[model samples]
Target chain A: MIKIETCLTPEILHLHQLEGKIAVVTDVLRATSCMVAGLNAGVKSVIPVKKVEEALTYAAKGYVTAGERGGVKVEEFTIGNSPYEHMEEAYHGKSICMTTTNGTVAIDAARKSADQVVIGALLNVSSIGRYIKEQQKDVIIICAGWKGNPSLEDTLFAGALVDQLKEEVEITDDATYMALSQYQSAKNNLSEVIQNHASHAKRLSGLKAQNDLAFCATEDYCDVLPILNGDEITIK
Target chain B: MIKIETCLTPEILHLHQLEGKIAVVTDVLRATSCMVAGLNAGVKSVIPVKKVEEALTYAAKGYVTAGERGGVKVEEFTIGNSPYEHMEEAYHGKSICMTTTNGTVAIDAARKSADQVVIGALLNVSSIGRYIKEQQKDVIIICAGWKGNPSLEDTLFAGALVDQLKEEVEITDDATYMALSQYQSAKNNLSEVIQNHASHAKRLSGLKAQNDLAFCATEDYCDVLPILNGDEITIK
Candidate 1:
């Protein structure tokens, strides 16, 4: 089997090469990580969109529009980028239309190659790997970098998936080794290590971001793999 | 001061944002890492180009055109992507134009904004960090993700840079953190972890790539940073 990899930036998408593979979409800094956190808190599903307007449009259809910019929850939206914010009381059984600077775009991009696109994050990293192995298909892990550039956080998640899945399949592409080695350096002091990436510092513009970072860092906290189908992302 | 936070792909230069920042370009799987290794092995400053034709034309000017496709060194070229291959006797003090799948594109993009764009790799991880800190300007660490997507291996290097420089500055991007965490996970199994990125597996297609992986996994071996100035990248 082939392992397809891509980084999400505004203009380019590795979607072309990811066809017929199990598309594992990761926006580790917030989206996928948040998805894992929100699901663990029992939120039903998250509908990821590329733009705030899309999230709003989806919310108009009885979904909660969750939007964040530069890391904080948009004051106008029901939820912020932080998974901790996602744990609030009103989240249960609700459909969230989530949009962010990086993750949302990544989720939307991964939608292109997704026969079965699973959200892979620090919260449930191994779950996605295990799922891919169980399905036994070609695996494509797309990192939704901030605003489409390669985010260190997203690639690290991809690297983690690579570490877990390479035993089962043949991986192709340069990104695989770049990430695997990078993961080797900072897997311990995650917060300190990622401080160099663009999104973490931008989100940290507010103080609560530490909680967001901490929340997203928890591993295997939930088993829900949010999969995108049509306009909605639901746990499969 | 605001830590310069940005991500780099094979395309989309982000020139406006990264302009005037100390740009650190990393293509760990082979390009940047191999560049460092080649330089360390006594090869001269490496040249980066987008197309194979450009490399050949440069070689006509008394330079060496090194090329790589699907990880293996092309027989026609004077050198392959492997740093080891670049350690040939003829390579000494000779300029080489490297055109790889993702790395050359990334180096080209960073050229637009770079006040001083440096080639970053596991080999020169700490020295580059020190140089950036000494400069006291915004530092932009650009990862040449695989064909514009975050390859875990590349971004993990970004994380290592972030980790090295965290106390010296700030990390605004959430993407950085995600990679940092993955780096944390892979730190213990450096050689094995690096062997798992898409680029590594792809490069290992025929050779004993495991050896290359082991070589790339050795961290902080060199304290030299290759600075990119216009079309020329200098090892400082």
Candidate 2:
């Protein structure tokens, strides 16, 4: 059976053995969700950078610089970390160089450790499951938590992904079991559960990004599978 | 409102703010459970050491040397990490120098970071809740997971403690929220849930420690509040 595990936060990613495994990195509140939406909207590719300065450097090469520091968009970026911003016609056929507090760092970390890294979010949950099932490889779901802390929304996404693929794979550890259990409990009303229980969702709501939260919580809105090839995430 | 949080595993303990906060450290399958049972059975004080050599040094000072590593009792120690072993009449009024795989490491970590550190388990869940409520300080429930990875039993205990104190304190962060939800889902049948879901419980069962797992799953078996005062844990 294919083995599956979960790293609840990027802070604990080091504890997970990602070598030779497919790493599905998730930032459901916005970052990975934005990638899924952008890719589905016909964006050429997304280059996830760890710093806003690195994203700005891509702007010199005509790439769209998009990022967020806290919940707000960085003043230097052309777009923020919101999924809706990436879903517009202006981003179609364009390459985005994106940076955010948690998502990019997690992606960068997973790329170095795993044999393959793919972006996962509620927006492409079923697609991710289908892609992983076809790969038939050991998988680790890495949650891009808020600032080295575990985020409820990311975990919820991880759980949702586990719920999708548990029957076809062997859940390896307690982290995966916890995520699956949490997802099982909250699957019926993910949007309401996340809005009420997730700290990052509350932070986003405070910044008037309630629409982003609702959009990110949506399941299978996009079938695009964002996989890291060299440094850029493109459709697999 | 008093703030309450959970450090799901000791690997992520540094991410939590423990200073001036009460740290309730738990290793439900069974280190902290052993401490609770020992203390309740009239053991004078339990000195938790991180290394086998450190525990052996106290044996020279007439303390009962007790511990386990990888679910087996250390050959150098007089007793293993079973609650039943700690509850024996031979241990009454005697001091124990104990070391275990995860629990002592977590206890040592929390003792240095938090203003006060106390041992917790399902065996003393209600008592731990009452004690923390009386303290009225910001609290962080530290789960002594298996090695550096999170364990289901420890998370379940953390959730149970959160369930007991949720009405009296502000549940802070996503970890606490996750713990509370897990506990809520499993509260009706903790023993069955743990027997089926916890990796540690399964490991213990493999080691012929099924009785220990059942004993540790029991709630309110003891009201003893084992608080770490300097180097030793004694009744608070």
Q: Judged by TM-score, which candidate is best?
A: 2
Which TM-score value belongs to model 2?
Answer: 0.98
Looking at model 2, residue B200 earns an lDDT score of: 81
Interface RMSD of each: 5.1, 1.0
Candidate 2 lDDT over residue span A1-236, tens digit each: 89999898888888889999999999997899999999999999999999988888898888898889987899988999888889889989999999999999999999997999999999999999999999999999999998887888888888999898988988878888999999999999999999888988778764448777788889889788999999899998
Per-candidate TM-score, first chain only?
0.89, 0.97
**DockQ, candidate 1, vs. native dimer:** 0.34
Query: On residues B123-223, what C-alpha lDDT tens digit does candidate 2 reach at each position?
Result: 99999899887889999999999878888889889899988888888877999999999889988988888888888876875544878888898988979
Model 1 regions lying over 4 Å from their true place: A1-12, A15-18, A21-107, A117-145, A149-236, B1-8, B11-16, B32-46, B72-76, B82-85, B91-93, B122-130, B149-167, B174-198, B205-225, B234-236
Total clashes, candidate 2? 0
